[model samples]
Target: MPTPLAETLTQLRIGNQKFLIDFYQRSRHLFARWAQRKHQLPPDKAHGLLQDTLLDFYDHVADGRITRMPEDLRAYLYGMAQERIAAHVPAHQPLPAAEASRRQRLLAQFNQLSTDCQQVLTYFYFRGYHFEKMGGKMGFPNATVARRQKSVCLRKLYDLVRGGYEPITGEVV
Candidate 1:
């Protein structure tokens, strides 16, 4: 007889919603513990990986990739979690002296940007705020406005970092 997971996998392949929910519920805890304890992905990134791997697994099964259900479904989920983390995580390294100097200079310029620019950039890039929420917080009319603001601020920051200053006055141009 097919295992519960094997039967569920057959239904999951055909885009069965209940099976997908069952899969998610069954795998969620293992995905969390393994992604953090074994892989050391930050909590937020790990959470994101959980959702992404779920979708990826569904996509793979939907596209005829998982022809036969694996003997161990939890192990399969853990493997997928590890693969997803590996694909996204950057290798850790100490900054070179030249790059450190550039970073310091960039930080100084970033600090000199308008307070609005600082808030917008910090919210989006550093704090990971959604554009919609950031727009509401920053009192913008909508996310589109916040997105445009982010683009303009990012360009100004890049320019400032790349030496876009007055030749004699040393003021930002």
Candidate 2:
């Protein structure tokens, strides 16, 4: 009942590693060049943006947010990349001092987390992994367990930050 393109996307969402690799290979260079030329991003930033865009696309497909395949997949990706570029501050721009300090504090707190907690958070947020993929990578029994672990880790992080727990002394102030 699905179009070929939709089926392909479904395959991608369901862990078809070869198809995902092919999809990235097919688009990476083209997207990198397009982003660099159109948005004036540096090569590395353009490539990074492309990677993030692809992950976002995968997430959308997995979550049923993308109910219909776009007529032009490249165009859809380009639009998403453009929006991401607009949302992010350029690398050359400096973060405000207060924001930088806050980030430093948060990162310090993050470092105090248990190794498993750190890995789970990094996998979910930085690597943009779905729960199933995260479960596989972390050797969890199932996706639900992975999701629950991530939630617990995130809650711990939130409490540490909100309660002003000192990472160095391991005490709340």
Best by lDDT: 2
Task: Quote the lDDT for 44 in model 2.
Answer: 79
Candidate 2 per-residue lDDT, tens place, 1-173, comes to 53476457545544444555566788788777887788887777877777777777766775568766789888898898788778983433444789658756776788777778877876786556899999999999899999998998888889899985854322221
For all predictions, the C-alpha RMSD in Å is: 16.2, 10.9
Clashing pairs in 1: none
Error of 2 at 118 (Å): 33
Q: Which stretches in model 2 have alpha-carbon errors above 4 Å?
A: 1-3, 89-173
Q: 1-173 in candidate 1: lDDT tens per residue?
A: 53465446545543455765766777666666766788776766665676666666776765567766677766786787777556764433334789557646765677667778877876776445899998998999999999998998888888887788522222222
Worst 10 residues of 2 by lDDT: 164-173
Q: What TM-score does prediction 2 earn?
A: 0.47
- Each model's lDDT comes to 0.67, 0.72
